[model samples]
Target chain A: MAEASSPGAPPAGASRGFGRLTIEVRRSVSPQLRIGALAGAIAIGLTISAIALVLAGVPASDLAQEFIVATLFDPTNLKAVFVQAAPLVLVGLSAAMAFRVRFWNLGIEGQMIFGGVGATAVSLAHAGPDSTRLVAMFVAAMLAGAAWAAIPAALKLLMNVNEIISTLLLNYVASDILLHLLYGVWKDQDGFPHSLKYSASELIPDILPGANGGLVIAAAAAALLVVVTARSRAGVYMRFVSASPSVAEALGVPVRPLVFSTVLLSGALAAVAGFVVASSQEGRLTQSFYQGYGVSGVLIGFLARNNPFAAAIVGVLMATLVIAGQNLQVFYGIPQSMVQLIQAVIVMCVAASDFLTVHRLHWAR
Target chain B: MSLPTKAVALAAASAVAWSSVALTASALADVFKIDGPPKVAIILFGPKNDGGWSQAFEEARPELEKIIGAKIPVVEKVPEDSSAITPPAERFIQRGYNVIIGTAFGYSDTFKKLSEEHPKVAFLDASGITNGPNLESFYGRTYESQYLCGMAAAAASKTGKLGFVAANPLPVVNWTINAYEMGAKAINPDATLTVVFTGAWNDPVKERAATTALIDQGADVIGQHVDTPTPQIVAQERGVYGTGHHRDLAEFAPKATQCSSVWTWAKFLGPTLESIKAGTWAPSPYGAFPGIKQGGTDIACCGSAVSEDNKKKILAARQDIIDGKNAIFVGPLADRDGKERIAAGATLSDADLWKMDWFIPGVISQK
Candidate 1:
């Protein structure tokens, strides 16, 4: 539905760029077109990454093997991808949940650290029976994460302090606390800067012979999130809040409580990620385990448009890229920085495509 | 379970474990043997050209290749996390590589687990703490070379005040600090060595700030035990002298670097790899601690500032250390608090060196 003042000529109110071109905000986009645009964006990203890798001296065949065959067809490599993806999926969901309510939640790493510390504390204390130890650790991790997250959320709500600054700064405080424990009280018998390894009972069990339980837990969380965000009454309220906070409040939605609860839930999810990494990947509370995941979580949420299922897919895709990056470095001696550069290029390309969904370019006479 | 109950149970389990261990003592000393021709692959914790610790290993790669007569490929910037370490290491093993070299203390646990899972593969880690029959963790007696660098720093200083930038108060780092102080005092009796811990291995910003602060406090020469050459670069910028660590800082600050305590990993690893190939490799139970004589670490000494006489003196001291005539941590050592550390006529043991937490006289630092 073009609004033109004159039939064969440009309107007086037309944008003056090139005296003929105009950008029109789309009132609605068909689901098919939206999917097509997203698919095209992802395709462009992959093509760009593939070309960059080839130019970086990775043979095209090897690139395919590393990116697809090794990661997907090979069972062990696939397991490794899932092992990495589980934590990423939780972190992505954590970021997505808070971001949907207009909160940055940059303190995901900090919350994760607190979660790990809390789990380690439970193990060290031997707080429950063997059957209930894991449950206790999980609950403690979520609570710790929520408590850490509460600081920035409260500051934003009560004192009107910027959440971005508070959340980002709290990461440093959490890091110092982690180091203090690792270097001082919680150090292992070997005097290393890491907590003691957890007992067998403290570790996340394998769901099957070779399948990691953390992956199952993460998938369940994602599925639950899909249901909650799509079907629940709170989900409807959340959508209203996201659309327009003032309007939603005027229409009787409890905006503050919704935002506060969402942020706390986000923190709890991130903490679960930390617990998964510690229990499933590292096998102990270790320094530097939480590194780089915050950025990955935010990026995954953005790419998925804060949709839980899409975030899960993007998280796995990200894990695949990480494994492939390691392979490129191991096989071709490409520096990690180059791999990071390729990833940045792909993310930028996909992000630029978001513009296509929001507006349409019109050719005016 | 309750805490006390858990502790009692743990103690009982350990006592039983120890008796079983004693019963199986004969099996404990079994020598590790490689099954076939050795294929070496290295994992670096930082970039290959990181200018310090990681670069030291990368520079040694060519020498190792020549010794093994095979290419030694490396994966750089691998994090300390097991998830990051395991895939590349497993891939290397899958590809038929038998020998894996890890270059971080953080790699200790993963390397230990990998060594157990693949008993035929030999694993060697630098600055690591875990060792098994098929795994050996090794570190240099860095204090030996740092002592020599100290002499050079003292010789170069206009005033008798020296400052050191260190990573942490870990025993290995502390030993270097004490040795540097001893070496400086040997050159200038009244030299007071002040230390500032950056609490980081490779933060150049912190290193620069610490260097400037020390220089402002009348330290004419600066020494560093941190990973970067930032201290040396800052010394050059501020028109002062500094000693280096990991690699030759003269590469970065040619004019200001009086001496550098550099890792000679190739000199140490070449023979170790040869022994592994020859099936005579017996990894130490307590990890390898090679000194300058065994080529773990040595110094690049004497910038233009050091007088010829001082250079000769430093070289003679180096020769004495190599000949086992001069042990830096030998008896009559005392902490700055007037407390005796090493009693007279007795040398500091390797275990004691590793647990060293107190400073010798002339060394100052924060609590």
Candidate 2:
């Protein structure tokens, strides 16, 4: 109670003065220095991208223009990036949630695939243009995703199985299952080894005229996550567990259930992302679908420092890089693999800068 | 709480969900099956919307379906990767497909294996070398059409230089380059043809870059084997003349690019399907030389930029090739190493033509 009312203990003017001083201090840091740092990071990323392009026999000038068009200039390309980023943000949020409880739910990809499969099954079963059916399909998708995640969570809790290996292994199994559905029983009777076209009844209706509605749902989920983390008892307990598990135990926090629930939530969220992509864009599940959303989500979560809002921005940026890469391929003679190199460079720079945030850079000489 | 109890509940719920989904799909299929015609499958390497080889296949699908009186099931944008192709082919075979067509050169091995495994199913592969009792390989002689385009390029060029932009330096592509050079030299003995290989089958950007570089180097006329409108667009922008390969690109840059070596796949597909339906699909390595007479290879309508005299010359050359007055591959053919590949005044055998891997004189290797 005293901690909550600490603002009253300090005079209002003093508190206001402190806040003003903090802002002033931040402002005093040269804007040029900040811009320079960002520019340096971008330059390093471009250098790596350029090297890859040259090796791939594409000219560097073409690759540079592609980066510009993808990130800042083209509205259509920018929208494509945001649409791609939406799913990654959800998956990143899921990972961040699990990380908060020190539970590594790496099987987010498998869970998402299972979720898509479940949603697809529901859509196939209830073929109609009813909103209720769509809602039911989404719910089933979430449940299926949660159930897939729960397997690893339960194994970690009860059988002492390491989640990293289990989750990674499950990805292959899930992929095989998807292949089986596409090639075996669910094969399109029209002779192609592809699933039948999903009807309008199965689709998640668009949020706006152009953008996917899933982005709105993902943003809401992120906002809710932030509010829960900042304002709720469960959120506080999660933070406590993350900081010191022993201390949380002493404070009578139920560690096992917390870990289980958090991981489950993470898996279910990842699943929803998969559900969105499969239902919204593809309308049918393919073996190569969900191309690397899970792994990319892990990178996004790291870049954002597990901040849900920041993860959304980072995911959008990553998506922009991809679209821009394709544009570069179309407009210029730049290879698409250059985008992968840029992503790798960004990840490295972000990781390096994270160290700089905590420690000063020094030269021994 | 307990493991057994949780497992039981999970199994029960999953079973319920699975059964419900199965029942729904079956019911929907039953209702739709009676109304819709039986579906035929068309598996291709790229997207139907890509406006290239896959698009060509897609265009031919509806026509084939119309002839067969069946609803065609098309799997577009399928990857050419081995891991994707093998399983998908097996699945099609298992699903009792009447005819399975693979429209890529890479699917040769897979189709051969599948055809051997499923003898009853007829396999048709485009640009593939696979042949079996139930499988047939079909491809057109693109070099003959390219030769006619080459004559037009040479006759129309202000500069004595012509360019050929190819996807790869493979035998099939090399043959076009060789024929183009031979035809050009036949029209203007001083003409030199520069050839640049982009090392990709569908990269538009590289094709554009190669075209631009050649144009800058004073090559007034160009031809491309790449599958995109980049070359045509590039030529239009630079106020130069170019010829199209594969499908018609006159719509892409109608003013700048005059005439195209159009490859109509329907000519081969119609006969092959008829043969398949009649149970006479043999393991014949059939190569069609569909020139102007067959309408498989024809000079597209020339743009306004092309002069009347140049158009007449192109048409005359087309007639000469169709009437057998001019032989594109009649050799006196020599390899890059100066070895006599085709003896003087002797026509090359089919086996020799299929395994052509050398560049002719005046054609530069960009590898």
Candidate 3:
């Protein structure tokens, strides 16, 4: 674990020059046990999911075999995992960057949805199709996502509202607004709650036909964030703000501005994910445009411990588990609810691992 | 079977035969055929007991199993994405399941691709648009049955004002709403249908809200084109009359469901599977569009709230539909915009019916 310091600036306002006594973290004596604990916790969680499924009537043996096949055997299935991972990587990058500064931006889903709206609106505006349309759509989508992300940021700073609650609840508002438009203003004459299909010139061309070409953006974000977060001054200041807010304030770090930047960038990436998905195969925005990508991004971020690059890797792995695990429902008669249960359990394990991997508690003064 | 049940079953059987009357195509020189024992597998787009669209298939699985003389395996919650649809389909094929049944419009493209890739497997998708030599898409003419339910709604209504809760305004749902209005007019000339599209297939909360909103706005009877019996359930809670889609909503809200446009997949899928097994299966190029006479959708009619006389009239109207004595989207029709759509002597084509975006007179909707 990285030690906390006033990397951003000099400690500004400590009249006594000595701050109040505080507890500090040291590396766990048995640091090696942390891996074992995390792995064990994950195993237990998955085991519980399996046991519940078996009790619900799925054969235990078949479940085991399916997991093996899902994880290793089928090359085609592995490719699909990454295909689904495309949006997750972008959204996860968004979440990872926010988490680095302790912004807790749970509104990634809504931000992504707004992104889709912006892109779709731009596409519908007859922006002359293809590259022109793609560029405009991407810009509009990023701006829309940033705008939505800023809402919660403003609320947090002005009203002292908890972002977790505001961002989570706002997901419903965002979806409802989408529904309103789908059913009302933006509705196509086709009667389905979807937008008009993008003309060939309106869609972003794919780098590879099956793989979403827009994932290049996600990869770029990962690479760029790896630098900005680890090698930049803002990155060091962000660590202080996240580790100790009082320390960051005393160090003359503008916490609100930093938080604003974190959430804004996070929102833009999530919106990029929304654009990639809408343009991927759907060709048009449909009712299920969200497709759990936003929440999955949060999961990937936590699993990757706020590292943008790791978030991209974890995104693909998580997508693999989801894509392969869903088949268990089809082949083995396990319910979709069970798959969701397994995910919930895995997230809990990840959260626990994050705790165990950082910040040791001490009692002696 | 009792007389009504037997009559329905007979009509259902004949409907399948009559529906395929126009469908006469030969398979490609190299086409897939079932081996020794016909093994069947089904892929569902949602949970088995979704209480609507998917449930209709599950409800008829036993009959399908019986007719084919084989046990069928079913997988649920398969998404519309190609990757999600492909793996389970391949797994079933690898396990020696020769015939695959899918239930989703999203499955159309993937089903077509899979049909081409695996020339040995026969694919049947409900509501799918894409088709290959090995794949055939089919959907029932729900409007034909929904029209009858609309009649029931009108007959049950204290006021001539009715409300419709719909999932999207697509052609299939549009035809149903139009027919529903027509049917309502058949009972009461002045009856009006006010439709509220909930913009989803399975969101019960939205359905309930739509239903309640309609009821609040002087709609004595509610008709639903959305999945889930939520509209019917809401109708029952509010002590109002309602009609249902996909399956018999009477099972969910007995007192409220006056009529239901129900899928008789067993009666249809059974014979279709047999045709496939006999090596005479001809996948239609434009897809199979069947009505009451062809066993796509039929009416589960007349709750106690509807008089016996109305029930008899509803049954008679159904018989008329099954015999092709009437055409719903026929000539002399004008959209609400007062533009002539079909000539007096002509009828709407399937393609035209699917792209229907206009409303007829007396039908008010957000679309």
Cα lDDT of model 1 by residue, A1-365, tens digit: 24442356554456666557655668888768777887788788878888988998888887777777876787677777888899999999999999988899999999999989989999999997989999999999999999999999999989999999999999989998998898789988766678999999999998876668889889999999999999998888889988999999999999999999999999999999999999888889988889988988999999888989989988988888788777777778888898898778777877777677777776766
Q: List the residue pairs that clash in candidate 1.
A: none
Candidate 2 regions with alpha-carbon error over 4 angstroms: A1-365, B1-39, B87-95, B285-296, B335-338
> First chain TM-score in every candidate?
0.92, 0.82, 0.80
Q: Any idea what lDDT model 1 has? A: 0.89
On lDDT, who's better, 2 or 3? 3
lDDT, candidate 1, B1-367, per-residue tens: 5995685576467546644664677565434666688899999999899999999999999999999899998999888888899989988887789999999988998999888677778999999999877789999999999999999999999899999999877889999999999999999989889999887788899999999999999998999999889999999999999999999889999999999999999999999999988988888879999999999999998899999999999999999999999889998988999999999999999988988889988888987
Model 3, A128-198: lDDT tens digits are: 64658888888999999999999998999899899999999998899988888886778776555568877
Better of 1 and 2 by DockQ: 1
> Which predicted model would earn the best lDDT?
1
Best DockQ goes to which candidate? 1
**Candidate that would win on TM-score:** 1
DockQ for each candidate?
0.58, 0.03, 0.25
Question: lDDT tens string, model 2, A1-365?
Answer: 22222333432223433442110112133446544554576677767767866777667666555567534564545556656667878888888888888877677789888888888888778744566777777788889988988888899889989988898898878876886686567765533334676777776777786577777778878899888888988899899999998899898998888888888788888888888877765666655556577788788787776767767767777766655554444333333344456667777876665544433322211
**Candidate 1 Cα misplacement greater than 4 A, ranges:** A1-23, A29-36, A361-365, B1-31
Question: What value does the TM-score of chain B take for model 1?
Answer: 0.93
Q: For all the candidates, what are their Cα RMSDs to the real structure?
A: 6.3, 19.6, 9.7
